[model samples]
Target: MRNILVTGGAGFIGSNLVRELQVRHPEARIVVVDDFRSGDFRNLRGFRGDFVTADVSRLDWNAQFRDEIFDAIFHEASITDTTVHDPYLQAHDNIEGFRRLLRFAEPHQTPVVYASSAATYGICSGVQEESQPAAPANIYAFSKVQLDNLARDHARRFPAWRIVGLRYFNVYGPAESHKKAAASMIYQLYLQMKAGRRPRVFRAGEHCRDFVYVKDVVAMTLQALNAPRSDIFNCGSGQAVSFNEVIAILNRHLGTRLEPEYIDNPYAFYQPHTQADMSRARAELGFTPRFTPATGIPDYLGSLSPS
Candidate 1:
């Protein structure tokens, strides 16, 4: 727990997680791994630490770990966009990277805390629980399901290794700079609104997602890392907010703004009415998210302001 490796540490959630960990464990040195493609360098630039700029899925962890031993590894590296699905690349990165990391951790006994997705719960009617079993609808969701299953099987075989995966809900805040439409819509929409454009909404504006704030996500993630429960937990506020509601919240903060423009569901991939059943996370590991979108939006906007 002293020295940690934050894969995709320069990205949205990982960047914030690293910052939180630095303050909580001030003496601890964090090693950040980022390709900085879809992940931005701006997120990592503010943090004080060493970094490795390379594709995580391709890197040989055994050789990488030969120099230093990581007490914990946060495996956040993955291809997230559903619009751009190259099965070969997705499987290799999302699926294979996990196996490689597991193999590396086999000898060192360093526990892994990796990012799973709420996307994996694609098209579910009710709140998704760890025990309910996942039926992902897209390649992105499928990849995480595969990783979770792989981790489970591997854990059974190698009883010594402890692996944790988090099903992160709609994570949003500063430093989320992914430009793709499928990325954090809140941030993208905010920027668009600030520039006198309305935030686009899904066809019905009825699709709901558990929009968990960045800071809460970071705190819960650290707790999971420290607790080492060796289980996959859903990280979210467990409340659903529709896209229409999100635009209304934005308008309220900015003193009346453009009305949301409805559009066709662009991606043929998957969109679900997403909410998390975080009972397991709260009861077992003592994790409770503090920020709701309504309360979080003002601060989020304030932080992003150039003034």
Candidate 2:
């Protein structure tokens, strides 16, 4: 059986990936570890697998994971919430979590496929690629960038192991049922419009992102683990779309003519543009994102309804 260890499996994309892998690979024994922090536990309500609720940093891997060696590690645990005030705490959990996981993986020589961020390419003008030097704007972005750098150097030393750092763009899709503060824009916007409450738009919504679907990201990540060489790849939809276009697509799905209400931008922290150059991912991992907001929002939103 293919033994897969998924960190942060209770979160949005992680939870979805857990479900997908379980269904596809029945013989696989999936171990999910999330501290019940950013990711909701309810996300794994019907999940059938080995559920170990432990902080990724505090995990006793040597004892708990002694009998078995992991085939792959989905390193998704990190500090992503923007409302955080203490930068020190964020670094400890987000940055240090991977540091510990790395130490664990290195000894076992397990292939670790981790979630890197597009935020690593902050304030850049050209298409964001793996070659671009990471310049993080916020503390959260900084932690993710730090993790990517660690992976880069780690892979260089351990050429025999598969260490993939996937720089994920604006990822959004199903299984995100948390509040406004927890879920993505698409999910929150759907809830707003459905409840007859107008969703507010900020800064004329000109900023663009390579909004990749969760399913596509998972597929590419799995492919990365099986790859022969260790590398970092931009896992994102090749097409860039504005935030306004995202809301427009959601409106069509709800069958409502509700237009977005422009509001004064409150959160000053944001990346103006985060488009990706998926050329490397395509060439290396044969990764290509299959979902656009227009085509995907409807179904993804529909799946997250209050049942």
Top lDDT: which candidate number? 1
Tens digits of per-residue lDDT for model 2 on 147-174?
8888888988888878888888877887
Kindly give the number of clashing pairs for every candidate. Answer: 0, 0
Taking all chains together, the TM-score of candidate 2 against the true structure is 0.94
All candidates: TM-score:
0.93, 0.94
Task: Please give, for residues 167-262, the per-residue lDDT of candidate 1 as tens digits.
Answer: 999988877866356558788778778888878877878788889998888888778865544788999988888888888898888777688888
Worst 10 residues of 1 by lDDT: 177-186
Candidate 1 residue 156 Cα shift, in angstroms, is 1.8
Superposition TM-score, candidate 1 onto the true structure: 0.93
Q: Candidate 2 — which residues are off by over 4 angstroms?
A: 267-269, 305-307
